[model samples]
Target: MLGPVAAWDPDGTPLPLGAPRHREVLGRLLIARNRVVPVGRLVADLWGDEPPAGAVGAVRTFVSALRRALEPGRPPRQPSRLLVTDGPGYVLRAGREAVDAWRFEDIAARAAGASPHAAVALWDEALARWRGPVLADFPTAAWAGAEQARLEALRLDAVERRADSLLATGASRDAVADLRAHVSAHPGREDGWVLLATALDRSGRRGEALESLRRARAALAEGPGGHGPGPALARVEARILSGTGGSAAEPGGMAGGVWDRAAAAWERSVPARSRARLHATAGLLRDLAVTGAEGLGEAREHRRDLVAAAEATGDTELAARIIGSYDVPAVWTRADDPAGAGELSRAAARAAARLGPGGPPALRARLLSVVAVESRGDAAADAPLPRAADSPAAEPWRLRAERAADEAVRLARRLADPALLAFALNGAFMQSFATCGSAARREVLGAELTRLAVGHQLPGHEVLGRLIRLQACAGLGDLAAADAEAEEVDRLATRDERPLAGVFTSWYRALRTCETDGWAAARPRYDALLATAAGSGMPGLSRGAAALVALVPVMRGDGLPGPGLARLDAGPYRPWLDPLLLAASGDAEGARQALAAAPRPPHDLLQEALWCVLARAAAAVGHEPVLRRARDELAAAVGESAGAGGGLVSFGPVARHVRAAGRALGGP
Candidate 1:
């Protein structure tokens, strides 16, 4: 199962597993994880859509041969034990220890939580189970491809993990040869390059380490998608170039070593620590923080410690950099933590003040950009900017954010660094929520960001740029371009193992289905998107999806169930749903009052969908004023699909909503 799918006798001599088809039958049963695989499934799996008249007979013959070979010493009248006949098919009753692949998987699973020494031994044992390519004898069998790929990925991961353990055990030089072979065999694996370079560098061959990184970039560029060296590799190269001796591995690969080096450097005396070392550590920690939710708390704690240390040393630039290093991809401008954002914003301001007016413009730009993004926290709502009386306060914050973003971009342009420009462009795009033409502004910024990210080989920023473009495309009604961007987003997310990046893509796909078909048809897709979002720890996306799931009945003019209305009221989209829910509940006056008091939604991705919901609610309650307002706001987007920008839900064509509002207002 681990390699060629062959069997051996108990004493060590190999037992011939009959011919190819016989082996395939055994392999199929084995792949079922000891469950019964019906003869019909085996025949279909072997022969696909078409099968011969004697296909069932051929399958039985193959299974009989496999049974005989597997239980060669069984009594003539005894039933087969290893490959026993079940109701309609055969079952491979092999124990876990009897199968190499199962044993390998068990070992790898255990190695995940083991100490370095133990992990290395376990990974070694796991790798030893693989003799060659998985299911090598069934190369042409379509059924084997997925399992083979899964096993191969596990093998490669084990190899990398073993190297990481070796590095941790201070045997970096010993891992060099294996890592070199790894990158050569799997050029597209960014982690392999990082490990190989780290091994070379730790072996006192800095030149070769640098060359390995260059080769990695070249190899990745030549691969199928022409992706550049990913963020982890870029951080590794930066650390190596800074001479910080930081471990060049992803957070999940060798997090202990990376964090230990960073902690040691940060604890050093001010005079002893170089700015380059501080930069390297900060970059490493920043990448770790954004890797997933598990590391976020620790990364934030370390960031605070580093900030305090920098403040003690009067290193304003370092403090500012540490405070502003969060570069997670954001769709909505709302802050996740209002209190934390305020604290960081104040810290950044203090750092800037300490630096005075003539400090490094680049550092100042970065601090200002962080402030701009953080100031979006008028409240702690995870959804888009809510419409309320206090929303007026958010207006001043939005204005201040725009001002700060403008200055940041100007300073970034002056510095002429592509990375800085990319950062500034992100802030600019985030703050591009002015009353009019916001989507156009975001589209332009998105294009510039994409170009800069591509030119500099910043794959993370490239994905961000594409996400911005994707939103812009959807908002601007360029469904074709939006579809392409969604496809590319999925590609990059898959290539980089960034599941969070695929959340938006999943949302867009479901929204497209909703537009083409109807809400009933798209319900399953939205449900799946909700699951993905929740699994990825994106509460805002999940909340919005849950709200949309509840609104489907309202859109269909069906009675809103109690549980559905409860879910609708629970999310941040409550304001947008209030009027709809009220009208559905037969509270016409309450519905009209809610629609009248509802301030226009912010000009973000969800604006169109929110407006459509409001319009429908107003029409249901005969609120002419609200209907006319919805009509006017949605007029320009007549040809577009509502909710396209947000990718959460859809109300079909915007024209439908606009026309409904117009009819309700006694116009067209």
Candidate 2:
């Protein structure tokens, strides 16, 4: 009867209720559940405000008919037991469990406090009993409306609870998908957004977490009062910002102070039993904000407490998450410690598996990329830029990382979330850059993402997208485009107050100056850029600037610097440049050997420049074969003109010089 009325005889044969009206009467009585439903109210519900003059008599006739159907063998004068008439109305005698709605509610109430895994099963069973809304076929019936609303509300609560259980079980990705739908349907619920944001952050999509908070605020803004985001929403934003190394500590200290006060309030106000997760989160944020290992110890202690508390609450999923969070630092920082890195990666993978097969692609991609980076070995101090990508065919781990990044891109695109898309695109682009050397694939992706980010007004994404495009352009030997894009990046960075934007763009400027005006002309700019980068306390950019500084002697055709190759071993470019310096110093044979032993050059503007130098040296040494190969490879990498034109300064002059040398040698 929970879904539709089903009456049967003792022998399991169908027993027809007299008519639709008779069934309606029985449904009303069943819904009443042993309580008196006055005839006056029944008449009004069955017929609305307007009713026939004989409505009461008609209702009585239907009730009598229902009684007869229930007790077919009753004596002529016997009173009914199942459907009995009171002074003003009729009542149906039935236990609460006899009604599916009542039973579902009862079970759901009990399951809320049960172990999460068990509760998930229990809630699924309870929710399964509800085929649809209560009395779904009779939507216009007055008695059904209130009950329908009440039942539906309970259903939503059960869904939310089930999602919470999933999250506690380390099924954050699944939880995120469900909560997205839930919030779309019920945007007024702050808890849904909180859960969604936490799940995103846990899945390693920090940008998505902040975007979720913004969505929440936007939803709430459409509410009656038109107020800004609540304190809870702000807390979630603060946590995300802290996790991502964003500016949580605004100038004048007000914003950071507010976040501190809010964290304190949550700790003090939330029940002690429920505060473990909050404490762990706060501690982690503090650890991220503080330099070195100052806050790490305390953060570790909080994570331990959280794991203990989650296990105590029978939430194995939550315990797994706590452990996963504890391993994040090691995952990013353990490249020098392969044993520890492998152990952490394996542990994270196991935890994700417990969340089931379709775990968060973003999280999986992050872990896989970390493994890829570790496998690539330590960054060459001279190679200022991170290895952009690794070929999937290179090694087993590399394949896994590429596949994971691709999957993340697919998933993020399907989600159509700006922040998530940006995150996924960066992963995909990095893979492309590392393996293929910033080809058309990465250039197109970078341009498309930059446009999308601009359209969406996402400052972070815009900065990233612009930088990606600029880098790709530079790699493609399109310095004119790179210069324009660099300017835009600087403008956007200033607008967004993202100073790191200027660091890379400044390096490009120095590169351009050295290529067109020679190293002597660009030396002061490089020096100033290096100083600025170092002062910014950003080690990567500083390393990049230093790498550029090491190239001054090569650009000026002055051979190696006075300090020699050892001091000039600035990064990835050193191997390619050493040979050119050797040739310049009249060691043509030695230069040829160095070029022969050089690593496969990255397909970039700088590499093209090196190829030009190699070609010139090959021509000078009468190595016609080497000269042809260098010329052909350079043309393939940077277009048919040997990377000339397009206002690009670097390779054009070098390529011309090499070609002039070839002509002088009677070589093509």
Instruction: Please provide TM-scores, in order, for all candidate models, with all chains considered together.
Output: 0.56, 0.46
Question: Model 2 over residues 350-425: C-alpha lDDT tens digits?
Answer: 4555655465554544433333332322221123322211111243444554675566577667655565566556
**Number of backbone collisions per candidate:** 0, 9
Model 1 agreement with the true structure over 454-556: per-residue lDDT tens digits: 6665667888889888877776677788888888888877655556677678777777676667777878987776665555554445655677766654554
Q: How close to the true structure is residue 302 of candidate 2, measured as C-alpha lDDT?
A: 53
Badly placed stretches (over 4 Å) of model 1 are 1-285, 296-318, 342-357, 376-394, 552-563, 567-569, 596-599, 622-625
lDDT of each: 0.73, 0.59
lDDT of 1 at 646: 59
* Candidate that would win on lDDT: 1
Task: Give the poorly placed runs of model 2, Cα more than 4 Å off.
Answer: 1-253, 266-357, 360-398, 434-440, 474-484, 514-520, 536-538, 544-547, 550-566, 569-574, 580-598, 602-633, 640-667
